[model samples]
Target chain A: MPHATGKITARELIDLQSHLMLESTLVGQFNHFARESTDPQFGQLCQKLAHSRTDCLQRLAQHTNITPIQ
Target chain B: MYQDQVTDKNLCLAVINQLKWSATCLTGKILECEDEQLRQDYMQLLNRTFAEQKEAFDLAHQRGWYQPMMADQQMIGQVQSDTQKLMMEQQQSMSPMHQMAQYQGIQAPQGLNNYQQSFTNPNLQNQSIYVGGGQPYYSR
Candidate 1:
């Protein structure tokens, strides 16, 4: 079982949290750039990046068994 | 397993700093764009991203991984007033300054503080921060 013995190391916890924040921030940056872009294609590119980050965040959330506190 | 050997706090700081930089660069890009559809798309992405990042920040602060200095109300108020003044002067402002004026005021404590005390309370730790030994839960 993951986190077997129900004991998660500080490293793992921090790693997870850092990744969560990183992805969350990336999503915002991607969107911000997309908003400023003139090419619809650039917007599409940002869409892809944000979606990718969101998926990573969701997966991280699942692994940690906690909904991100907003 | 993490990719580096750095301390958790250090890693969090590094990651947060980089994220902040990325956001700054994007903000510049957003301000330079004239395309409506593209702007709308970026706006949506920023909205979603800002929300998610807020959560991450709250979590970090809760865990003692980060403690941003408390707000200086005088400076904050001045900045807010200046922004409002600018917004008033240029009702049809095409700059991101206008968009920034519309963003939420987060320098003041209110939303996240409501639940922050719980995370810091030692008694509440058993229910919030740590789960079954040291298993991290980051419960909201």
Candidate 2:
């Protein structure tokens, strides 16, 4: 019989959090760079990167039940 | 049961690390691109990769197989802190120049501000003036 234990491992939680944060930071940096960029191409690239990061954040959130830091 | 759990955890860690490295590569490419369009394209690709990585992370988490591969959190924290400090230093180095330019603009715009404000106002159409004493013209 499978026991319904609400407890989860601390290491797992930390690892999940760390990866999510790293992805979020990367996306934020891309967005910031995009906004600062004068070149249209670079701005577009930054936007794309920011979008990717946001997607990653969403997926991670879905998996871990972690709400994004708005 | 313990062995199976450990194996699953290791596998999840491996997948996560792979995704992390891929993301790092994308980040490097973004930093390297000089052309804005190229950078934008690469950033888009990076985003797609990040989405994939997130999916993988979520999959592992859902299965309850994820585990921290790093033994020392302090080391990672130190590196992150150092990176933040460097970024702050760079921003601070550039801020004074920006502040000076802003100050100059503000000082020079003492009269221009009022002129601009008047021109922008919709209700101030009756007070329009040209070089010559033209009639109060309301431009569309």
Candidate 3:
């Protein structure tokens, strides 16, 4: 059943949490790949991909309503 | 000889695969989700993933790192017909019991079933493992 209020269901929460983790890992990997790239254009492409992943991570994190623990 | 290191093409291919999987998963979740806002959010994410996947794929293709053969129309039509024939055969082969099971949603137990069992079983309660760290908000 769908949650009526602002709260999300457990399934949604789990999915969001997993997505956040996956996106975070991807962002890190892309950033590293960008840094290590020999080709300038490929480096730019990696950076762009990293930025996209960061945006996704932020969006997923926002929906989960959880502050990242330091 | 150069030392071993991950190539740009390999990284691009990995990213493309990840984005493709993300898009596929989001599509399935969007279809299953009944919540309007959640479905909208999933759709937006899926769109972004599709775009990112295309960008990565195009880059790889341009670099001649990921070239796929183009199938002719005849082969495509043959495959489509074959798939349709297979689907029809499968549908026709379904027994009454199979249909009844499907209607009642009786299916084989999945990993989630065992996971749920762990929570209910007293002996297994303490043994239940948690991944991704402890988060209070998500449990709410």
- The candidate that wins on DockQ is 3
Of the candidates shown, which would achieve the greatest lDDT relative to the real structure?
3
lDDT of each: 0.55, 0.59, 0.73
> iRMS values in order, in angstroms?
20.0, 20.5, 3.3
Model 2 over residues B17-127: C-alpha lDDT tens digits? 755785786576567545444345446656777775676567567766674476588988999999999999999999998887666554544464456556666664555
Instruction: Give RMSD to native, each candidate.
Output: 26.6, 22.1, 19.0
Candidate 3, residue B96: CA error in Å?
22
Interface RMSD of candidate 2?
20.5
Residue B131 Cα positional deviation in candidate 1, in Å, after optimal superposition:
78
lDDT of 1 by residue, A14-61 (tens): 545665676687778666655654546445655666776777567555
Question: Least lDDT summed over 10 consecutive residues: which range in candidate 3 chain A?
Answer: A1-10
Arrange candidates by TM-score, highest first: which order? Answer: 3, 1, 2
Off by over 4 Å in 1: A1-70, B1-5, B71-140
User: Per-prediction DockQ, in order?
Assistant: 0.03, 0.02, 0.16
lDDT (10s digit) by residue, model 2, range A1-70: 1112333245444544665677777676667666665546445655765786687567555435434333
Candidate 1 docking: what grade? incorrect
**Candidate 1 lDDT, B1-140, residue by residue in tens:** 76455444444454356556545544654575444433454455456556645554664676687887887999899999999999977876665764554442322234544455455756554443323222334563
